[model samples]
Target: MSQTNIPLLSLKNISKQFFGSTVLENINFDLYPGEVHAIFGQNGAGKSTLIQIVTGDIQPSSGKIILNNEELKIHSVHKARELGISAVFQEFSLVPQLTVEENLFLGSNNTKGFFLDKKKLHQMACQTMEQLEFSIKPEEKIINLSHAEKRMVEIAKAFHTKPSIMVLDEPTASLAENETNQLFSMIEILKKEGIGVIYITHRMKEIYKISNRITILQDGHVVNTDSVSNINEQKLVELATGRNITNLFPEIKKQRGKKLLDIKNLHISNSFIEDVSINVKAGEVIGITGLAGSGKSAIGRACFGVNKIEAGTISYLDDVIFDSSKQINDISPRAMLDRGMLYLPSDRRAEGLIMEQNIRENISLPSLGLPKFSNGFIVNRKIEKDIVEKIGE
Candidate 1:
């Protein structure tokens, strides 16, 4: 994509302060038409704040947002959309009870005489999804859609407005490899249509894959801005973190220990794994890597008793928790956890932890029932706090 010299959108001397605390300091950035300008940063690097300013979710304390060489004052998201600007944030903003078409045109003038124009809505939804090359039915309920499909719906909603500039923040956070490729294809389509994309992500691979220009932001400050080809992966990491990862990595020691977990002839029904065998030893950091739907998560879920095994032998330290041939199936999540085997789900917000709880509460939640933290039923706050603090550290 060949971007023009004049930027479609520009943030000059942008600085934001909340409660007298400076979050963004003199940030200058640009987004040219038909350009994928990526912003790389660690957590608290003010990426969200910058996007919020661009989308009119918040106003900057100082700086000017120039659109097409003209000054623009965007006070809200509605105004931004009206000005040919749109954003697809990391969080999904769809109602679970609503259908895809309904969520796509939500808050829009899709009604005729107080009645929803279903045919027109469907046509528009399908058209926008076709443009994005996403496969999802218009009438499907949002609750029934998978994470990837939900993400696509969000993007489709944003793209339906036909914005000149689009902001995508961590768009591939929950998507699989194939789904990510699909998103990249859509981005390419956007580029061809002369839509300026401000992509914010922490993934280095994505930066090299799609972005034309890379801007590194560290501690809410712009460190460097250059072409992706000009900066390699190692250089990118150092620019983002201000340190080399090789110096932080612990030395690998070649030592073997007794087997802690052993699985043989594992077969999960309705999954990609037909026959799998693996052994985990003490003091071993085993990694099970595969593409989307390639049985990596299946194996972990099966070991945690979350997924039923059609045929397999799962042993934990010589204790046969599950053996299909022997007709012995006593595997349970509680049993696995009690046996010192833990599994973290892929969707942390939905399955792993309670989003409403604070960090201390979430950390102590799983250990509340243990003897050290609880006396029969009541929890010991002092002991729990002490343990939780150590675990947090």
Candidate 2:
């Protein structure tokens, strides 16, 4: 290769292990200037582990990370940022209580003086958001912003660093189509500025549209790495999953059981879900989709009792769970869960799991008070362990 062909960053024989189990093995990858290199894989295929190692969130068991032809011993996230590497992970890192401007410069050296220069910081944040064409107020609290807005803020924070290497892990997972397009445009701008981008996503269309090269990981190993033009979508999926994906989508079965949930003239005043009526069958897999502010999420939240219904009625089988006419409060989340209703929030870190807790503890937390896992007060260790194991399997 010529001097101009040298990779901006290269991973040489990278491998990672947790406890005694291997998570990544001898993974060799290259990210060249002005190109998008995508890492594609199924869940647990080590894509996240690889990115974490590069970002200095986790240490690799073996291998070297070379940036600008110099070997780097990345020990912490701050060190990686100092080395001109920035990343926007799948999970949002913004503090919910903080304003957009605060979150943008949270740990950055941009904040000067004993007290934060709020005026200057706000101006800088507005400029950054404008550059990305994101229409969000810098003074708005992160908790009040929509999921897509938060994702844009995360991207803005990473872009503000002006890094030579930018890593985006599933950046568009929560974004609407227009927001995704905006992000793609920003990536193009970064490429024009000679920034090497590492895009980790499972979306095949994205790889074909924006990536220069594609690297597939399977079972902790690099299955293949090739130019996007050299491989088709089916081949890429096969490589990631380690099996032939004959159908891009599974066949849609029309069979549906009795109506399990019925919402009639539902109106959630706070969320703007107005007079929406929906029926869900027992065996149906329903998809509710719309633009960013279209009240799709509110429906799910109201159904699961997270958002209160202002009017209308919600019936589950023979029972009227919620009826605004009767002025009854919505059923609690615990009551819904007991009745086999589960809600997987989009913000998994805040709503789903306890980051400080281990996997076993997080998994067993909701079931601790159940009779099967506990004897009214004391938890049966064996039962809890078995439940966790079963759920993991």
Per-model TM values vs. the true structure:
0.85, 0.91
- Model 1 pairs whose backbones collide: none
Q: Tell me the tens digit of each residue's lDDT in model 2 across 137-180.
A: 99999999987888888888888888999999999997888888
Which residue pairs collide, candidate 2?
none
Give the whole-model CA lDDT for all candidates, comma-separated: 0.88, 0.88
Where does candidate 1 stray beyond 4 Å? 1-3, 15-23, 56-64, 68-83, 142-146, 174-176, 244-253, 327-330, 380-393
Residue by residue across 1-393, what tens digits does model 1's lDDT show?
A: 663799999999899999999999999998888999999988988889999999999999999999999998899999999999989987778998999999999999888799999999999998988888888999999999987888889888889999999999999986789899999999999999999999999888999999999888888788999999999888888888888777534788878789998999999977989879999998888888876657788899988888989998989898888999999998878777788878788777767889998887788876676898888789888888888788768
True-structure RMSD, every candidate: 3.3, 2.6
The candidate 1 region of ten consecutive residues with least summed lDDT is 242-251
